[model samples]
Target: MSTLSKIEPTDATEPVAEVLAEVKKALGAVPNMAKTMAHSPALVRGWLALSGALSVGVIPAPVREQLALATAEYNDCEYCLSAHSFIGSKVAKLDPDEIERARHADSADPHAAALLALSDAIARGRGIVEDAALETARAAGVTDAEIAEVVGNLALNILTNYFNILADTDNEFPPVTPLAHA
Candidate 1:
């Protein structure tokens, strides 16, 4: 059970309902996590703003999704791990094997592998990534800017992961079901 109770669509009212309506229109469904976040509209709005800004950044969608999944896995966040895995497979066209490999931060390919390693390193709150790791990222064609973006993405995922743990948010998308507890 969730530590925070989700605000149901049926019970939404006034200012919160307005935001919930926008959330529904945008996502097609009010994810339980969003409902939990509705406890503080400012938090929800701030999260939305940050997400919007990040979406417009230079990182490829696949890389962004992979980073999110990797971060979630490192943090043991079932909610985000499940959600991002599904997004990785369906929205980003990442292969199932690749997704699983990313979840474990294990890969034969250096680029994908390096990204996983870098994301994991940041997820641990380690401010300084080793020079060799940065070199690996550079060899993968990742720029210093992209590395910074990955750090930002890592921070984003950590925020969401912590929120999921605190709220025990329910999974909304069906495709991620099998892997939710994996």
Candidate 2:
């Protein structure tokens, strides 16, 4: 159960319905999370804007997915953790073991271990990582632009994770639930 009241969908005309329509067209379904956001059109709109910004930002999709998954795990957001997990594996072709390994390691990737280490540091909210760690991330080929985008990725996941906790958004992606729980 959510601490926040569930907002049921209404067929009536409203900005929220427009957002819901866009969501439905995009996903072929009105996800419970979006529906919950429909309770406040502003929330849905904010999500849309932030999502668009992140997509157009400098981070590559794969790395952003990794950041998002890591952040969701940190927040214990069952819904988002599940959603992004599948997106990473099925859509992005990221190895399942890679994600599992990444979740616990400060250095998740053998080739790009430093980047993962930086991500882990960020996930821990250690706003002050060693200068050497930043140098390591740069050596691993992470750009200043990508670092900024990583911050956005963290923010987006934090938003969704907290929303799920507050809204108790039902899972739309089923396979992810067990993996997230484990």
TM agreement with the true structure for every prediction: 0.87, 0.82
Residue pairs with backbone overlap in model 1: none
User: Which regions in candidate 1 have their CA more than 4 angstroms from the true location?
Assistant: 106-109, 175-182
Q: After superposition, which runs of candidate 2 have C-alpha atoms over 4 Å from their true positions?
A: 5-12, 26-28, 105-113, 175-182
Please, what are the lDDT tens digits per residue for candidate 1 over residues 2-76? 889898878978778888887887768788888988888877787777777778787777778877877777777
C-alpha lDDT of all candidate models, in order: 0.77, 0.70
Deviation in angstroms for 30 in model 1? 1.8
RMSD of each: 2.5, 2.9
Candidate 1: TM-score? 0.87
Rate residue 153 of model 1 by lDDT. 83
